[model samples]
Structure formats: structure tokens, C-alpha cells
Target: MANNQRIQLKGRVFITFNIKAVTGLHIGGTESGIEIGGVDKTVIRDPLTNRPYIPGSSLKGKMRSLLEKYKGLRQNQRIGQGYIHSCDNPEEYPNCEVCQVFGVPGERDFATPTRLVVRDVMMTDKSAQDLEVSGRTDLPYTEVKTEVSIDRVTSAANPRQMERVPAGTEFGPAELVYSLYDGDGCDVQKDIEHLRTLVEGLQLLEDDYLGGLGSRGSGKVKLENITVALRVGETYAEEKKLLDKFENLGCLVEKLKELQDQIRQHVGK
Candidate 1:
């Protein structure tokens, strides 16, 4: 249980896919100065393209949150307004699925390399172009919806504008780079199994939602057209495709047991 053994880098797994909005999606953008009733909400956009994109941080954080909630892990780490679970105990950290996959603070003695890295997902070219030319959409690459918050006591109606990506719009070529580390041991079975954790998070997201205002019917999404590949440490330069063009993450989840055997064959050889 000593923290002296060097952590060995086994390899890395790359998962690429498409995320389609099942419902209107709203991931808020920053507004420096806002006058009353002037677009109360806006979607985050790429500075260069001015196109809305799903940030890696948002995607990764949501995945972690969902996994933690599913596992019913104790909420200890306070992030912004909400709390998240993080194992402070080195002995217990290895057993916590959330910690093992998402990782704890690097400063912690028990901290290992975080297994997952979710990349920012951009709006598909076709979706962007279609939204622009449709002329039916309220905004460029997005739509605006007005909702009123009625006061119970005074019955005052406070209406606010919300910007969202229209349902059926696709944002993808999204990628999740998961690391495989053999900590203090040559065996990387645990690292490989962490793949399940990633898939589980994706599946949970499908059942749940992404971005904000999920309860009020925004952020429902689905993953599709997945491609997974592996890069072992020995043959790092030559990456091998494991599951080429799986229909969805659910398919990957279904065959994870067999997939592990495939990974073992590639990495072990």
C-alpha cells in the first residue's frame, strides 16, 4: 500500500462518435453586458467559427456527475454550487469506480492519471448549413424559446428567453481519450475494464440529459456512429481499430466483455 511504485503507462483508448440532440439543447454562453429583455440566454459559441459547440469540460463533468450519482457515491467535493464525490483515502480510492475513472486531485498521494479526456464537440457542417438556410429557425445554428416563471403570491409573470439547438441537430466527431495505466503492477485488466465506466456514463447520459435545464425538456441527446481504437505502449505509433463504426455506445457496452478480450490480445502481444 506504499505510494512508491512508479505508475506504468499501458496505452490509450480513443472513442469517437456523434451526438444528436433528441430535444432542444441549451448550454449557456457568457453575456458581458445585458440590458433588460435582450436575449436572456444564449448558447456558447466558438470564437473563431461563431458556431455553438459542446465543451469538453461540460461533457466530461456531466459524465462524471452521472456516474457518481449512479454509484451513489458520497458527495464530498464542492464544485461551484453542487457537491461531487471524491475519495480522499488512498486505500479506498482504488475501489471507487468514479475516482478510478475520473481521478482525484493530482496533489493527492493516491492520485493517478485521470483515465478520461472528452474533447469539445462541434456542430456538424450539414446541421449548421441546414439551420442557416432553413429560415424557419429563430437564430443562426439555434432557436429561441420564451418561458414564463409565474410568481405564486403575486401571480407576476417573468418571461425569459432561452436559446437552444433544435432537436435532431447533430454535434459531433466528439472524442473521448481514455488512458490505461498499470499502477504498481503489469496487469492492466482494471484499466481496460474502466472502458465500461466510460460507456456506462454515455449510456446514463442517453437515459438522462446533457447541458442545462434538463428537467424542463432541454439537453436530451443520443450518441451514434462510434469508432473505437487502441494505442498500446509498445506499438504506440501504430494505432489499431478495435470497434470500427459501432452503431452506438450501447452496442459497445453490450460487447464489452468480448471487447476486453480483443484489447488483451492486442496489448499483450
Candidate 2:
């Protein structure tokens, strides 16, 4: 007799914040890696030797970690369970915002919709049957479209800084994304100064370029080219002609200068 495949289970209602910043920071542990030109280079660094390259796996791994941490997700113990799935501990169940939605149940673990993802979930150890896997769990989510920019130091130890997008906005999965700028966001100059103070505490070569801590032994950064352009003109007309191209090149120079300084500081040159 074919019994009905219906079983009572709980559903969770919570938000999962996706990565809006640049991806491909890891030099290992396959996520989505960056291709310098044609070849996919690892962006992580080795702890023993400092060098810069890209690691596809690293990129993906970090993203997974971020999502799991931010969402307070548990590991799926199942074999083919999807990444970012749900955890239902038949043991002492962890209280979660999503779990609360399902009401209190002692027998079954926290069950979620099954998801099929490229990589396995790294954080959880729950069974595969308990996970809700997908390429991205946000596929079914509704994005609250609002543009907000934040200006934060890209790195404290490095001169690199850029305006980042604010949190809480939903955008489709992108390799890299930034928040819109707003006055409420962190002051760019002030943030940079703060980073300067913290710079000394950081060891350049000892850190990975893209991935943060575990990636410390993954890859390194290399300075490629530096081009400086000078503009000369007193009159508005003359200045305008030279200024356009020069101004564009000048920006590149600033970035290069920052990169140069970073290399020198790290390499102790």
C-alpha cells in the first residue's frame, strides 16, 4: 500500500543577506575565481610565501561561510544535501528565528526545502535529507530594491579604500557589487584615518589579499604597472584639452600609488 508521502514539518522565515561586495577574493577553495586575462589565477596567499593569485574554491568557500554565519545556519549532515540548507537536530534543537516559525517539535529536526548547489555547505554537519540546497537560496526571495552607498576603508593596513554599498538591500547574484553612497554612511576620510591606526597591527605578507584569515596561506598581491601623467595648462581652453585625458590617468596613478605603498610596506622595501 502506497501511504501518502505527506509528513508534517516546520518551515522557517528569516532573511539571508547575500554578498554585495566583490567576489573572487579567495585564492583557493573554489567559488568563482577571477581571470587576470585568460587564465584563472588563485587570489589567496601561502602562509610560508607571500604571492597574489586567485583561488576559485577559496572565493566560494568564503561566501558560503559568510552566508552561514550571517544567517545562523547549521550544517546539513546528508550526502547530496544542498548548500545553505536547513538543520533539524533530533537532539537538543538550537533556537533560531526561522525555527520559531515552525513551532516547537522535539522528534523531527529543523527541515527546509531541498536545494541543489555547486559546492557543499561547509558549516553544517546535518544529514543531506535535512538540507535545502540550491545554487542560491535567494532565488525565491523578494529583493527590497533600495540603493544605499557606504564609504568604508577597503583595508586598514593598505591605502586602498572605496565606497561600498550599504547592507540590507537585495540584488541579484553578481560577481561584485557595491552599495550606493549616502551621508549617513561612514565618512571616507575618517575611516581611512582609522585604518591607518590599525595598519601597524596587520602583517602584510602574512595576510591573504582576498580571503581574510583562514586564507592567510592562500595567495599574494603583485604590483603590475605604474603610469603617471602630468597635465600643464594655465588657460581654461588649454587646461580643458589636457585635463580630460590627464584627469582620467591621474585616478589610475592614485590607485597605483596606493598599491605601490602597500607592496613596499608589506615587502619591507
Q: In the order shown, what is each candidate's alpha-carbon RMSD?
A: 1.9, 24.6
List the lowest-lDDT window of 10 residues for candidate 1.
Answer: 180-189
Best by lDDT: 1
lDDT of 1 by residue, 82-138 (tens): 899988886788777788788788777757777888899999999999988899887
Residues 67-142, model 2: lDDT tens digits: 4454556655443445443445533333342232222323343432221112211211221112224223221111
Off by over 4 Å in 2: 1-24, 29-64, 67-88, 91-110, 115-269
TM-score of each: 0.94, 0.20
lDDT of 2: 0.27
Which 10-residue span in candidate 2 carries the lowest summed lDDT? 9-18
